[model samples]
Target: MGWIAVLVMVSVAIALIAFRVLRRKGRDDGDHGASSVDFSANLALAVYLLVLAYAAVLCRDGLSVSEADVQAEAESLTEMYWSVAPIPEAMPVRSQIRQYTAQSIDLDWPLMAGREMSPIPGQTLADMRATVLGLRPVGEESKNLQQDTLDRISEVSHARIVRSDDASTGLESTFVILMIISGLLVIALPWTLGVRPTRSSIIADLVRVGVVVIGVCFIILISHPFSGLGAVEPDAFKAAQRQYDQIDGRFPAQP
Candidate 1:
């Protein structure tokens, strides 16, 4: 499961704990000490909100960096495609490159998003190398194209390596602990302030609950997009595929 799902489960556990505490307090105090609870709850809620805001910013920056890496890989693939056109017998080689690029984007993207390794990244790399070796020519232009293709391959390979490293890192335990603490603090805050129990007080309690629920939901939604943080760009992948098809059409495979 993704970290978001795990975090959601943690939040639910916090909610249950809060509910039990509130229920017990209600039974013993009979709404006589609502004012005291309210003050404490408000204070806790304020602190939790501040911490959550900071966490959200950090998550956003991390996701942006991840996305940039994917884009870089896409650009490298594009350059590789352009460079391959000058090589002798480029059609078959172009087709192979296109397929590899597409697989990286379409298949590998989903796998990385789930923090899993693709089953065939190695096989794909081997196939690409074979294709590069098959395009034989002795001219300087051909040599340059070969070097460019190698460079592009290296870039994409490095991107995948980085993503693999990231997958293992997972969420920091400290962050998860802080999130749990924040949820608990939010629930406890209202009771500690000794707020009086009245119709208005009950309404205010409901409002606080609503605010916490909304905040949690928003966090979940924002985090959802990051689940695909290390995936390749679909648009750029498609462009490479198109270029591959064009080259294949022009050069037709040998009998």
Candidate 2:
């Protein structure tokens, strides 16, 4: 992204320099049309701003959706863990939940960043469902708790699949290319004016170019919610881990 931004800046700088030379020669011949050039440059800038704003919003929405999915998945895991606390016979189910959670955090997180799903986490979760369904309840209270646990387990499983799907989601490559093209146009539009190459005019053009470059770079940085520096963290899963640890150490025993 940085390289792309630099390329844009360099290209704009070279174009401005050539425009300056052309304007200097034209000025000697009294062949300048300042009013017309200014009108066209202003029109181009307006269009560029609209495109940039739309692209920024798209990237932000992608990030928000990814974060929401992570939060929902973690909350479901936490709920599933707590639901098993009341029934002693549900200990095996609780242990399975813990294993599934750990696998999701440790094994699946990296895969998510690469927009890939890990088979082991899904298999671990499947085994957890089987363990939950295999439980037999004796009294009415135990039966109720068993049903609640099963519901929560289903919620967790459903959330896990959604998380995997969200992990694979990102801004389309075509949109990114279009944004880059628009950014190039934004930088080059002013040069097309053939306006006066006054010091203030040149400085103002450079500032506008800088702003466009920075904005496009920001859009690129957040283009992928699961990859790069500003990408969403697995803090949700880590919080779930802490909650599990507070209730019981490493692995809970099965009754």
Candidate 3:
């Protein structure tokens, strides 16, 4: 992005200027504390890169779990819809399933950017389960069917709760601060290497600072599960809706 390029350029410029000022002020005492600075900077860079890798993994795991939860929820809805196709009286139940999915995709999905979901869709799912519980089936097969539908609804309810929790899953603020500190130390401490600031040395320092910026930016960009371009979408729910239509067209619920 343009913003990213601008930030990297600005950061490199500021770092270079700061170090050049230090050099002009005769701050570099030939190898006076070079070993200590070298050790500290190396340690800081190691910690920074390690934490960056961990944050990347955390973001990846959160997105993967959220995606799996969504697919499971959609699967439960499709299975529930199929289970109730034989009973004409369960028309309302089927309709409620569709309603819940629609509300989730349309209303709740948008709210996920803020790590939230509307209660309306969840309530609709609960009501569907209650309606199934109220059914008085005569035959053993009918009783089994009712139980199956209830189980499917329960699965959907569980998956929805998990998905909501997953929405809030991301890197913690404290961890981000730690990353920033370590990254800056890596950029700043290397100036104590006690070497004269030639053009090539300054350029090498600039490259090091640039790498730090890129790493930090990557972590920040991917730190959230529900926001950003790599966000988990409702594609699973959309596929479930398509499957519902296919099932309905084939079974053709009779009156």
Q: Number of the top candidate by TM-score?
A: 3
Q: For residues 1-255, could you state the per-residue lDDT of candidate 1 as single tens digits?
A: 455566557655765565556555644345566666667666776776886787677667666666676567667776777777666566666666667776776677676556676757657866777778776767988888887887778887887777566544444456445655666666556655433345665566556555665565455444422353332345656766776667656645555
The number of clashing residue pairs in each candidate reads 17, 0, 0
- The C-alpha lDDT values of all candidates are 0.63, 0.73, 0.83
lDDT of 3 by residue, 1-255 (tens): 454577677786878687767677644347787789989989999999998898889888877878888888999999999888766678888889989999999989899888788999988988998999988877788788889999898899889889888887778877777877898899888765545577776787878787888887787677767777488889999998999899889778777
Instruction: For candidate 2, write residues 83-156 as lDDT tens digits.
Output: 67666777876777778777877888788877887788788878877877788877898788778877877787
Candidate closer to the true structure by TM-score (higher is better), 1 or 3: 3
Q: Estimate each model's TM-score.
A: 0.74, 0.79, 0.85
After aligning candidate 3 to the native by TM-score, how far in Å is the CA of 74 from where it should be?
1.4
Give the Cα-based TM-score of candidate 1 against the true structure: 0.74
Tell me the lDDT of model 1 at 203: 67
Off by over 4 Å in 1: 1-43, 166-171, 192-197, 224-233, 243-255
List the lowest-lDDT window of 10 residues for candidate 3. Answer: 20-29
